[model samples]
Target chain A: MEAGKRINVVTKILAANDRVADENRRRFAELGLKVVNLISSPGAGKTALLEATIGRIRKDRRVGVIVGDIATTKDAERIAKHDVPVVQITTESFGGSCHLEASTIRQALDEIPLKELDLLFVENVGNLVCPAEFDLGEQAKVSMLSVTEGEDKPLKYPLAFQVANLVILSKVDLVPHLRVDMEALRANVRQMNPKVRTLELSSQTGEGFDAWIEWLKKP
Target chain B: MHEASIAQNVIESVLRLIADGTVQGKVARVYLKVGKLTAVVPDNLQFMFGVLAEEGPLAGVKLEIEEVPIRVRCKACEEAFEMHEEIRLICPKCGSADTRFETGRELLIDAVEVD
Candidate 1:
């Protein structure tokens, strides 16, 4: 049968990773925990936003965080200040993956006291392109886009905006210091993903944080 | 960047098919349909596929990637359109940001040719 079998198979390239993602989803669903895969480009303020969000919302909601990185444990250390159960997954062993796969999330889920938390924030490694392609079994995909990046970022990285459930425009307090067009950024995001909700936030000054705090509390 | 890993995944998938010992000869070509919105550069992915698919059932196998353009349906006017330019997604007719995408996020292998 090895001469000319010519069998046809239609398969998705990411099927293995996606299988683990679905498993992670079911696992979270069983534990009654909501998972949010937070993605962004480097220096998009994902860590600071998580720090601020966890600091504010952890009082009312039990939150757990899993930080994914290529080589550093620094972000996990930053989030540890909130006195929450934080797990760090470093991809250095696995060829330093640019994005977090569901298997890594599963491993991290095993490390954390998942049942004790209401929400689990899986902070994906900072990359606009790759992270948006993988579903880490999160209930929602959030991207923190810093105003310093540029107004044309949404147009350049449309997949990130397109897949995001919420695109937080971080570092907006610095808009005055820069020539960034905030209106154009928001409009581009709205045009890219009309279903995505957006917010402007500055983790430094805590401006426009109340809405995010409230958003976290909603069922 | 991730295309190399993605290309490896594609090869792994094809190798799994021939592992059953049904494939007749050396795999000639693997036909793939990748969406423009998936962020996969066809040339880059094909390059990686070439490097990784060596020394196996997939050795010298050509990767044929069919790029699909982004198609959307305007939520306001209910009109469908294909967008080729990388710009703000707006309905040419109704100018609505609230448009639903019909296609352009696929990354799948549709068929394989085995000699």
Candidate 2:
């Protein structure tokens, strides 16, 4: 029988992923590495924000990154320019999986010297959907949304905004040229996630980068 | 895309329960109670489950998704109603946006109808 017709198939799958995720979490704790899963829509400025964050924070803390992309090692290469340890997971190798699974993340971490890093940032395959469902033993889940992506993103992709503890509104420099309604975006985000902290800044302009860096540095 | 990952999480949780002797069997059905706000799309998730469960111990298990619509209980008038559409947080009966949500933000395995 096809599993879709009569089965509680989604539940079984989530249950299974949670099992491995727990294991991944336990291992992450043992290493004392604060894992932060960065998620956003494609071109929502996740890579740019990370580049800026790493440039400033790398001096004070030991950092590493695992970049997830549908194809190409481009992101990994971009991050490597900052001189941090990085690995790229190309999902095309695995039959076009959109989100990185706990098992895949586990394998990726195995190749990294976890003991040498203070923080490990797994830049999820540029997606706002599936990435929120899986836990990679991260200390915090940060969602990056660029202003150019518009304010309606919070309502449209409520799942990511709700799960996020910190929401970084990136590409703020474009706000002058773009018609983004900042107040509406903020209000929408607050409506969905009452407690989520919001930061507005541009990675290109180095605006609000300090506050973001300081927040991440906190225990 | 994330549905596949979600499917993986469900499998792991069930196996853990089974390993601990809390549940026994070649699995039957897994029931999840997801809040309407959760990022999961049931249709996409259902599609991914079939692919993920192909060769695992849960090869033949069923995945049932029950989406709990956003229900808010107004603090002022003490009323509860379903939040069906758009991004309105105001209580329809009281017209107050000050209502507190009691549930529907959850992504949990409420029950496992196992065999």
Candidate 3:
């Protein structure tokens, strides 16, 4: 007989990931809880944005956070200062996994009292690359890029920008000092993601935060 | 960093297939069709699979990853060719940015062979 070859297995992998992601999304929908997956490069102010947003919204909405980091509970520690339920998933526990998997998120969900919360924010590990590829069962995925990070970031890392429903331009307070062209950044973002809502705000001064809060409040 | 997590997804899927009578034990190889535009690092995925599978049901299964390059067809000239990264959308033949991407965003388990 001619040499018999083995069948390929890539389809099985993606199908399984999609099925689990769908299951997780369905569960979130059932709870009527809007889960937001927050992604960005390190120091893009993901934690700061979370703190500010949580401080603004937590008064009316029950907010919970699952923070992912490579090491230390630094981000989780900062988020815990806001007095909301927080869980930290270190990469070390999962053999240095950069993004939270559906199974991991499912376990984290078990830790949270879903009925008691209106929104669950998963602050994904601060890397623009790997986190964008995996879906964490979120109702919306928000990519945080700082003004200091430059405008070309979205064009360079197109996948992250393309997958996000919203792109928050964090640390706008530094815009005056930095040379970031806000208009060009917005244009590039619009080119990559036409429908992605862009918000420019400073977590420190609280500028443009109201619109962000209102955006999150909308159904 | 998330490569291992993605590999875990692959392993989980293969196991489910086995449980559902899709495949048998002792998988020889797993083939993946990954697109360049998908941003998945194939080496990281293979490394992840190797590490995770050492203790799982997919133990000893070989990983085969193939890259699928993006191709675009120009709206103006109807020219189809492989996309060059330096020039994202402009058609090389006609130098028009009005083109629709044909491929390069697939992430799928094409097939698996098991004992």
Candidate 4:
């Protein structure tokens, strides 16, 4: 070995994770499943939205959910009440992983009936930044922002908004009470991602769920 | 926060490379190219890498990071530019809202220097 010799190894640091994510993507495709990775900050209404979404779509489409959390199985329990196949991935055992990686998703898939479901939702751990960096092999990455969290979230956390395929303004029913500007939020999201779709909905009142369901049903 | 996991991944990547004979001898430094858009804090990443690599063959490995700026191309006018201040996707040249990111999402291990 020569002194101070350098080798060019231009590759992704997360290459291993990315490879597994590609595998998960293939698996999803083989099962003809539309996979969506839902990302958001804590208390952003992901579970509530899923409960509402499953209630609406379960009548026509078979749905499954993989919920990731730092400690509790509370989210998985919530989704399981909807009578859909649900898997809880508690990251506390995995060194409290802040983000749900591809390998985790791969393992969770074994617990669910993949072929029997028309759609699968990976409710990523509630943290906008880390989850945006990890690819869970989902067809779409739907990032959520509640009106209660304020409109500047997209600007403050640009990467989450930038990577999102669809930005959902959750808890919109309480917008009138909050000082958050909905239009500014949409504009901020657009500033990060020009072509990404935006939607507003409230799981409490089911205000904009029709559009959400319609978006889900799109080919 | 997530830098610990990322640092672990970097170590794993280097170890794999060494095991496969792509990286030879004592690893001295690992060069990384992280895009600005990535939420990674370089200082935190360096610290975590040092801690994670302390007991292994990568002990005392110096992690050198090169941050790449966010760059985007306008779809309407076909002009490209780099964003220095705030990351806005709109094209600076044509002022078109239709634009796409060209760079700044990278998280690559560019190369390594060994003794």
Model 4 interface RMSD, one decimal: 1.1
**DockQ of each candidate's interface versus the true one?**
0.55, 0.27, 0.45, 0.81
TM-score: which candidate is best? 4
lDDT of each: 0.86, 0.79, 0.81, 0.91
- Candidate 4 per-residue lDDT, tens place, A1-219, comes to 557988999989999999999999998888889999999999999999999999898887899999999998999998888889999999998889898999999999999999899999999999989999998899999999999998788888889998888989999889888888788888888888888889989999999999999999875
Best by DockQ: 4
Over A1-219, each residue of candidate 1 has an lDDT whose tens digit, in order, gives 545334567688899889999999898889888888888998899889999888788778899999999998999999998899999999887678888887888888878998899998999999999999888888989887999999888988889998888889999899999999888988888778876889899999999999888877766
Q: Compared with the true structure, what per-residue lDDT tens digits does model 2 show for residues A84-197?
A: 899899989877778777778988987788999988898998888768766776778899898888788888877687778899898888888988899998988877676679
TM-score of chain A of 4: 0.97
* Candidate 3 lDDT tens digits, A49-70: 9998998998878999999987
- lDDT by residue for model 3 (B1-115), tens: 5566678778877777778777765678888887777777899899989988997777788888989987767789998888546214556688665666677777778888665
By TM-score rank, best first, the candidates go: 4, 1, 3, 2
Task: Report residue B88 deviation for candidate 3 (angstroms).
Answer: 5.2
- Write model 1 residue lDDT over B1-115, tens digit each, in one string: 7887788889878877777764556778888989888889999999989888777667788888998888988878999988777745678798887777787888898887876
Whichever of 2 and 4 has more lDDT, that candidate is 4
